[model samples]
Target chain A: MNAMLDAAWAVFVRELRLALRRPAEATQPLVFYCVLALLFPLGLAAQDVGLRAFAPAIVWVSALLAALLGIERLFRADVDDGTLEQWLLADVPFPMLVGAKLAAQWLLIAAPLIVAAPLIALALNLQPQAIGVLLLGLLFGTPVLVFSGGFAAALTVGAPRAGLLIPILVLPMMCPALIFGAGAVRAAQVGLSVEGPLYFLAAMMVLSLTLLPWAAAGALRNALE
Target chain B: MSGLSKRQKRMAAVLVLVLGVGGAAFLGFTAFSKNMMYFYTPSDLLAGAAKEGATLQLGGLVEKGSLRREDGLKIVFVMADCEKQMPVRYEGILPDLFREGQGVVATGKLGIDPVTGERTFVASQILAKHDENYMPPQVAASLKTADGKHSCAPFKSLGRPAENLAGKPMTAAAEAPRS
Candidate 1:
């Protein structure tokens, strides 16, 4: 167990190091998130009331797309460097390594978006309670987004135009997270109980966390072969 | 011979794929179906399709000359999809963009008049669209006619009249009858 954890830690650090080295890649999704969020008010010519009404949906969609932006490369670098083959041969559990990679992706890519969500929510005129719910929703939802996206990324690691394929494959699976995430904020805005949607989002995260890494490891093995 | 035949391995792989995909789809669909409460048009209400007293969304344009104000912040208006109309009662400060002939979505329960048996939407929250150029996509989709055209064509094609209504005092008691 200790060895498995150490291997996973090493993989996590290596992935983070690669991500930090390419500063543009790390920051591109955050920039995309901000730009798309700001564009809603401009495109709608909406009043403050209107902006507030749609803020939850807009923020959720932007987060979904932004998380998607970096997903295609999740397994590509490791596969290209033949590290995937080495991991397959290693004594440490393969799924733990994949989980570490996904954890790193979520930390580096989705965490910033969750942190910056309040600023964008404020710009969209969301209520304080609603903004809080948005933050919680993102905290729970982004991991599911990363896991589902990572699965798609792994599945298409050997395929051509993986960047395009990842979104097409992952977006449909992302519907539950988007709905629950946005729904929680909307519920809070309208003085309804947000617990229902928040619980649902939490369930989705748990489900994805339990299932995705193993599926991704299986896909990576297929790609390596 | 191998520990497990290639055919057995292939069958096991297919079984896992089916179960995983099927289970995910089942869970997703069940959740979606449970939460898929959609906006009902006035016609749908009139058709008796909407459940009585269940909280749901009603989307349409506020009818001209149907808005009224009662004592203690109570406001009443008629929401129309051009073909059918339903009365809505709300007791709150409406969004600034709310006006006659403009699109709005009201979230509430369906109630029937005790005497007249008229279906009324008792709104808990009212959401008006942002501007003249924008309409909620759900409202737009619901308002589409049989010919794939908007049933609320006058509001869209006759842009001047819609703009004129925007300037009207949406919450003013003036010209608003007591109910």
Candidate 2:
């Protein structure tokens, strides 16, 4: 148990270290999210009320797109360098390592977006109460996005033009997360109970966190073969 | 290093997967049972699904001819789920697609009507929900009564004249001045 944890921790640290070396790539998704948030108000030319009404959807969509932005490179880089097969052969469990790597990547990508979400929400004129739900929703929803996206990325790791394939494959799977995450914000905005959607999002996160990593590891093995 | 065989490792993964999914399913199902109705129908509202002053969504078709324009922007209409009907009071510019005998979802709190002492939904926002099978009101009216007379039709005569805002450009924001 200790060895499995230690191996997973090592993989997690390695992912973070590798990401730190490419600062621009690491920050691109967050930059995309912020810029997308900025474009909505200008594009709509809407009044405060109209803007507020559209705020939840705009932020949630931006978060979804931004998460997509960072997903394609998830497994492709390791597959390209041939490190993925070596990790598979290691004594520590492959799924644990995959989970750790996904966790690190999620921390690098989704965590910053969660931090920046309030600023985007504020800019989009979201209510303070709804902003809280937006944050909470993002906290639960983004992990589902990352995990499912990582699984999609794994499926197409060594395939040609996998970038386009990733989104096409992953976006449909991501619809529930988008719905529940945005629904929670919309419900909170309208003073309706957010528990239903929020709990659904939490359940989705749990399912993805458990199931996708194992599936992703299997896909990685397939890619190597 | 705590050495484990490959089969044991796979077993542990399966166990974790099963346990995790089981736990999540439990939570999701419980939440679904608790809040299966995302929006309350008029029948659900009448059955005491929500308390007075509690915020919720009321979904139904706007009863034809039951719409009456009151002082200022206030409009009173009956929202019927084809089974039961509830009176709704809203003060704002309605959505463009908001018309009589169409699906509309109103979000607001339930309150006691001062005059009637009956429960009324005081809506803060109104969203018109329409599907691709767009039918003229006459077509819809005929189709609705095809399966025998709908009890909801009695309130049709009680409706006062509603201002036809078609072709007039209106702001999406109710209180926003026309620019």
Candidate 3:
């Protein structure tokens, strides 16, 4: 357990450092989120009805995109710089290493989306109660996003067109999270209980936790080969 | 003709092998059409849908009122090109922007009904709304001007502003999940 915690912690630090090193690029998703937010009001003619109607989806989608944007770096950069090779050669077990990296990515990417959610929710004029649910749903959904992203990054670590291919392959798989995340929040906006959506997101997180990390490690090893 | 030295013969043979292999592979890929996604216009797909396990890409606009959930998980929608429609079944959640009248690209396999063997496809991936502005990294080469300035790649195609757009970096390109 100690060794596992240590490896997970190490992955977390390395992932954080990587993001902080290029704060501009690291913040690019937030930037994308901001830009996309601005687009809806401009494109949709800025009516409150349209904005409120689409708010949950817009927020979750942007957040999902933000999380996805940084994921390719998860394995690509490590592979390119030989850190992944070293990690594979290291004393730590591969699954722990993979889980650790995913945990780190969720912290850096999803955590920000959660923090930024309220402000975006306000901008979109989402209901106050809905904003709370949106934030919570994202909290659960983002982890799954990170887990799935790790899987994609590991799978296409070295291909020339991996950058493009990864998104095509991974986005479809992530639709579940996007759906539940948005739906829960949307449900709350109408005074409905968001329990189902939140539970669904939580279920996705658990399912991903059980299956995705091993898949990611297997892919990473394949990438290393 | 003069007889070639051993080294010259070896180099010539290597050159021949390269040309031969390259030619054969190129022919094989193209003849097989293995690399490009199999594209079916909405009408073509509806007319002769194939059996299951055959993957295809169908591009069209989402049909109005057809974007609803049957079990909150299974999404049934229709893709149209104004003149034709292909029924689409997606078993998971959909992209946020999936809506009526938006252009979409769906990827999945064909399924034939047991009773009639009539074919329909199951799309797992759906790209909603065709956008006007796209500047891929590779497009950078083509986007270059005589002055080395980047060409204006606008998002207007996707229903956005034409001006003040950065090559926009898609900055969102990396947002797809890794697995």
Candidate 4:
């Protein structure tokens, strides 16, 4: 148990260090997200109506894009430095390593998006009632993103043009997450029920948690070999 | 040519051959498939010979004032190609990105005599093509473009590994807090 914990912690610390080392790169998604949100008001004709109408999608799209922006680095640096091979060759199990990196990724990338979502919501003209749902939706959605991203990262680990491939493969899988997360906010924005989409989001999180790490590690092993 | 090692030359030659064959095959298939992914403008969709149960993708600006919510959960939005409008019914919450004016693409089987398209979409994948540069490189490059539509290779195709942008400057410091 202690060994497993150590491996996970090591990966988290390593990723965090890299993120801190290059603050500009690390913060790109958040900036992109906020800037894009600003476009809503300028582009639309009516602020009040457009704000209510566009709020759900703005939050989800920003979150999804932000998630994608952080993905390439998940394995790129490790592969270049030969560290990925070292981890695979090490005594620690690959799944644990996968788990740790995923956790770190969520903390570094997804966590920030969630924090920034309220600002996005405010920009989009979302009601206060819907803000909590947006946050919760992100809470559920980012894990699925991290899990799915791990698989894509593993698949394209050494593939040429992987930066482009990750988004392509990932956006398709993001359908369910986008639907449910945005659904929750839309439901609350106009005083509707939230149970169904929230449940769906929860289900996706549970499934991704249980299955994605192993699949991701398997992809990593394939790329490594 | 001057920098090439014999072993590296062999690898490069093999790569060129693979790329040539793969690119040819993809182009051939796309032509054969009638260039499957044509984004139907709202008016185009209505004018088309949309037979019952024919699978199709409708793309256009989401119509304003046409949004109707059922219990504030199920959403129906209009896709207008400025000439015609097709109704897209989505269950569950939408993304913060889904607004009336934005361009959207919805994929599903055409409803049976207009069966609300519910049962069909419920069992199928309804996705929006948010951007033109979306498909994975291999898939895009491999896809048959017979109809000559969807031929825009907007993304810098498969030149670098995904990580090239990881350390690229974000052009904004506000993206990540220093802490």
TM-scores, one per candidate: 0.61, 0.73, 0.55, 0.56
lDDT by residue (B1-179, candidate 2, tens digit) is 54878788888877998999998998797557444355677776777656676678788778778999989999999888645789999999899989886678899989987767888999999998764455577765555532222222222111111133322211222321212
Q: Which prediction has more favorable lDDT, 3 or 4? A: 3
Model 3 Cα shift for residue A73 (angstroms): 3.0
Pairs with steric clashes in candidate 2? B65-B159
Residues B2-87, candidate 4: write the lDDT tens digits: 34455764665466446545554554343223312243344434444344344555555555567677666766666554334566
- Every candidate's CA RMSD: 13.9, 11.0, 21.8, 20.3
Give the per-prediction TM-score of chain B. 0.54, 0.66, 0.47, 0.44
Candidate 2, residues A138-207: lDDT per residue as tens digits? 9999999889889998898778788778888988879999988888887677665678788888888898
A56-142 in candidate 1: lDDT tens per residue?
999999999998886777777788888988989876667778999999999998999999999999898888878889999899899
Candidate-wise lDDT, in order: 0.77, 0.79, 0.67, 0.65
Best by lDDT: 2
Best by DockQ: 2
In candidate 1, the second chain superimposes onto the true chain B with a TM-score of 0.54
Residue-level lDDT tens digits of model 3 in B82-136 = 3456677887767786776556778886675343455555788887655564567
Instruction: DockQ winner between 2 and 4, please give it.
Output: 2
Per-residue alpha-carbon lDDT of candidate 4 for residues A1-225, written as tens digits (9 for 90 to 100)? 465567779888988998899999888878887887677777888656757777899778877877787677678778888887988986666766887888888888888888988887887788898899889989988898877988888888878777888888887778779987887787667554465567667667766765677678888888888
Chain A TM-scores for all candidates read: 0.97, 0.97, 0.93, 0.94
Under CAPRI classification, how is model 1 graded? incorrect
lDDT of each residue in A75-165, candidate 3, tens digit only: 7667777887887886565666788778877777778778888988888888897777887888878888888888998888767667778
The TM-score that candidate 4 achieves is 0.56
